[model samples]
Target chain A: MLEELTIQQKIKYLQDTLYVISGKWKLLILMSMYGGTCRFRELQRSVEGITTRVLSKELKELEVNKLIERKIDNTYPVLITYQLTPYSFSLKPMVDEMITWGAQHRKELSKP
Target chain B: MLEELTIQQKIKYLQDTLYVISGKWKLLILMSMYGGTCRFRELQRSVEGITTRVLSKELKELEVNKLIERKIDNTYPVLITYQLTPYSFSLKPMVDEMITWGAQHRKELSKP
Candidate 1:
């Protein structure tokens, strides 16, 4: 159980995970790339209101963590595709649970 | 897949979960209570570096979300015990995954 864990262990666990997805952008980026590969511009467009600088930074972090893969495609104009790695799918259950909880939260908020 | 969710849907999902555990303290608080009931001072001591003000705020939020239960014990002085609800255990897998990933991250950082 988590109670018996030392503060040092808990803090390290907290830091690493928060360090990876601390900001608002990373999870959004992950959601955008969940279905299939997305090009840079497509991802930028998908997340809505995320600036290129922030998106670029989140993408790099996800890539470094191996949650996503970035590939270069030499089409007419060339494209950089971002897709989820098998490792990232580990997040599926958590995200799905969030979606369920989020819907319920919205419902609760709307009650008069 | 999460990819297929519309931005509106994704945002709602993201906001709901983040709303629940957005900060450093919430998860740690959850971790501290994972094993069994804990008193107010015990949680504050377990988390380390958190102030009384922040602790109260986080405790209220967690209670509102139904992730934790609060009960008052009228002893000589009075004590409040915090315990995780079944709903909170839904987060067990995600926290465990974070702990695993965090350890790997620390190991990677320590590698020469």
Candidate 2:
């Protein structure tokens, strides 16, 4: 059985999770991959307005964190795609809740 | 009826939520006050190791976001206590899940 973490340890852990997913385009990247995997251009189009550099950087971070996996197909030019790992999929509900909460609060926050 | 927010709007909204809830000790503050409203000193004790300045700043931010509210007791010396707002209570599940996730990931990260 895992030992219980002290509150201080817990806070640091949360901070680290935030570190993995905290970039501007990280969550957007996750949301875009929700339906399934997609190629580089497809992901760029899915997010809309994200520069290629930023998107590339975010993808690298996600891959390093093991939240996403990249596969390459050796064809004429070669094709690469990205998808969420099972661990990343486990975060789906949390992300969805954040989306729902965002929708609910947006209107309330817009006024004044 | 509320219209669906554009993706950009949604991202901004989540960032806003993070802004409201972010800070070093905010979660700990919320967790400490979890059982009931706590007097200033009690809150300070609950979180442990937080400086008075940081506690004051975090409490003020929580009050501004309506996540927590303050009540004063009429006595020889005025006493102020803080409690979570109903809206804040709604975030309990999210926070608890975050705590659980943090625990699960902490072990994995410490391995390296």
Candidate 3:
């Protein structure tokens, strides 16, 4: 199916998925959430160096895209959890490829 | 190997490969070059809407990262050709996964 598309058509089709996961934080956020539902604070800590503001912003974007779902706990101390939607799980193979390719790239770049 | 890496290490490692390919036009440029060696002018035209300045900039960056190589023909017009490096071929599976996932995402989005 992929081979059928011209370069022009392929680029146009792929841009949507890339837009959903292009940022420095979105993939990292998704990777962190693969462990299942994580509280807002858990995500903040797991994705190191993300500011609370940026984390919230990325979360909102992911939720808007339906890649993730947000659940707010109605408990004594309110809590919120973020989890990857089943739809987002479709990205597993892409993430796996990135991991493999990324490892190779790091090794290649490390050569002096 | 990927499963062994902690999420922290994974993100840190993946960023390098992502850095090389994350822009709006870099992947498009690379996709265009999948046809084999192409001159600067050919690429400029193949990747629709990429201005000459941006094409030059992205081409230089791809060359710098060793994903693509540039060769000067030194012909009457002094042609320059760009080709993907063997190392960059490691990204083929990654690109395939993106094509598949990207197609899926587009289909899902088009649904009412």
Candidate 4:
């Protein structure tokens, strides 16, 4: 499929994808939610090293992109949670490839 | 495979990959080389938008990462060309996934 496209087209496709998932934190945030729905604090803890402010910002960006959905509950104490939208599942293959490549890269770099 | 790892481990793997390919230009530079070997000037033209200094820097980084090799022909005018290494082929699967997802993403966003 990629071979069919001109190099310019190929680069444009890649640019589109990167524009959505470019930052260091977006993929990490989405990866954490893969387990299940998560509260804001839970996500902050799960992602590790993300400050509350930064996590809040990344979550909003993901929401804007439609990759994740935010749900609010009107209980005595209102509850908020986030989960992956079906649309986001489209990213699974790419994310899997990244994880596999990343792990392999680590091993390659560690070789003496 | 991803399920077997803890979330932290997964994020770590991702971080490792992002650390290397984080910026916009690395993948673009690699993609340009897919056609065949190219000289510095040729690559500058192929990648578009990248300045000479930036392209030179990116090529050096790619060389250091072993994704590309620089061949210098010691002739009247030193013919320098760049080509992908076998190890770089490891990235094909991931790059393909990105292109597929990216193109799909553009279609997804254009929906009215």
Instruction: Please tell me which predicted candidate would have the highest lDDT against the true structure.
Output: 4
Cα displacement (angstroms), candidate 3, residue B89, comes to 1.9
Ten-residue region with minimum lDDT total, candidate 4 chain B: B1-10
Q: Which runs in model 3 stand beyond 4 Å of their true positions? A: none
Rank by DockQ (best first): 4, 3, 1, 2
Reference-based TM-score, model 4 = 0.89
Q: List the residue pairs that clash in candidate 2.
A: none
lDDT of each: 0.79, 0.74, 0.84, 0.88
Model 2, range A1-112, lDDT digits (tens) per residue? Answer: 1137665665666566566666557877887787798999999998878989988989998888778899999997998999988878767555555666656666655658
> Which residue pairs collide in model 4, if any?
none
Worst 10 residues of 3 chain A by lDDT: A8-17
**How good is the docking of model 1, by CAPRI class?**
acceptable
Can you rank all candidates by lDDT, best first?
4, 3, 1, 2
lDDT of 4 by residue, B1-112 (tens): 7779776787888887887777889999998898888999999988879999999988888887789999999998889999999999999898899999998888887887
The predicted structure with the larger DockQ, 2 or 4, is 4
lDDT of 3 by residue, A1-107 (tens): 98798776677766766788887889989988989999988989888899999999999999887899999889878877889999998888888888778888877
Error of 4 at A51 (Å): 2.8
Candidate 4 residue runs with Cα over 4 Å from true position: B1-3
Better of 1 and 2 by lDDT: 1
DockQ for model 4 equals 0.73
lDDT of 4 by residue, A1-112 (tens): 7779887888899998887888798998898888889999998887768899999988888888889999999996999999999999999899889999988888887777
